[model samples]
Target: MSQNYPQLDQATRDELVRAYIAIQQIYEEKGSIPKDSETILKRYQGLLETLGAIHLGLLVASFSIVLNFFIVNYILHLLP
Candidate 1:
């Protein structure tokens, strides 16, 4: 089958990966977190948002990587 997504070019993919890495780094650096538990929770929420973004990117990439290849080969075989 053909790709379902709109225009998701290489630059968009690269930016998504970069943002995901940056969010991951921030989440790992607990030392930078504030002393209050509430503040830490707030920071964690931001981290979760980043994680969600990363997860979405991975999902889209997987569709392109796995399904796209199969569709390409099938279409190529169909062509004379």
Candidate 2:
């Protein structure tokens, strides 16, 4: 089966690329992942999750607005 992937914006994609480079550099220099790098990655993950939530919220709000417009128009038409 084909899998669908979420499309990431350029800035987020660039951030991930930078993170990958940092991890690779740390591994090359120290032969293991450091605590600081792990923490930074975690923070990035949290930021991405928060952004996803905001997008979802905006989508829901826009849909509600469109629905409300139709509902109000229907009610108004029924009055006269």
Candidate 3:
């Protein structure tokens, strides 16, 4: 029974079963497992997220330098 499969979620049992059958069919047709399963997609997604974070950090640092330069120049201009 499907209830015996622990990995099956409460709602996705049918979908997972269909995908599993498709994977089997693909293996029969091409003799190899598909590498683009869910886990691989998550890993690539996380890598993209980390690269985005690095870019954001660089932008923030560049803006901070420009802001500090303007503040320092304005203060020096007001000195007697």
Candidate 4:
């Protein structure tokens, strides 16, 4: 089955083309450089630390939501 795609305006299409070209240029420049082992390790470590913090924050938020849900439900049940 053929699926219909949403039509984009001329301005939007032009912007997307510009973004694609910019990204292609960036990829070319990035591929030209091979960083030292230490530098690459440091960059990866920084990325890992950032992702870890994000995951920790999400875990805390989820735990708080679950705890609050139980507490709220317990309180509501006690009112009867």
How accurate locally is residue 30 in candidate 2, as Cα lDDT from 0 to 100? Answer: 87
lDDT of 2 at 41: 56
What is the overall TM-score of model 3 with all chains considered together? Answer: 0.50
Model 4 poorest ten-residue lDDT run: 1-10
lDDT of 2 at 75: 98
Task: Name the 10 consecutive residues with the lowest summed lDDT in model 1.
Answer: 1-10
Candidate with more favorable, higher TM-score: 2 or 3: 3
**Stretches of candidate 1 above 4 Å error?**
1-43
Ten-residue region with minimum lDDT total, candidate 2: 1-10
lDDT comparing candidate 1 with the true structure: 0.79
> How many clashes (backbone atoms < 3 Å, residues ≥3 apart in a chain or on different chains) does model 1 have?
0
Best candidate per TM-score, number?
3
C-alpha RMSD by candidate, in order: 22.3, 14.3, 7.2, 12.2
TM-score, per-candidate, Cα-based: 0.43, 0.49, 0.50, 0.49
Candidate 2 residue-wise lDDT, 1-80, digit = tens: 01233577667777888999988888867867664546765769978899999999999999999999999999999996
Q: Which is the leading candidate under lDDT?
A: 3
Model 4 residue 53 lDDT? 100
Off by over 4 Å in 3: 1-43
* Cα RMSD of predicted structure 1: 22.3
Whole-model lDDT values for every prediction: 0.79, 0.81, 0.83, 0.79
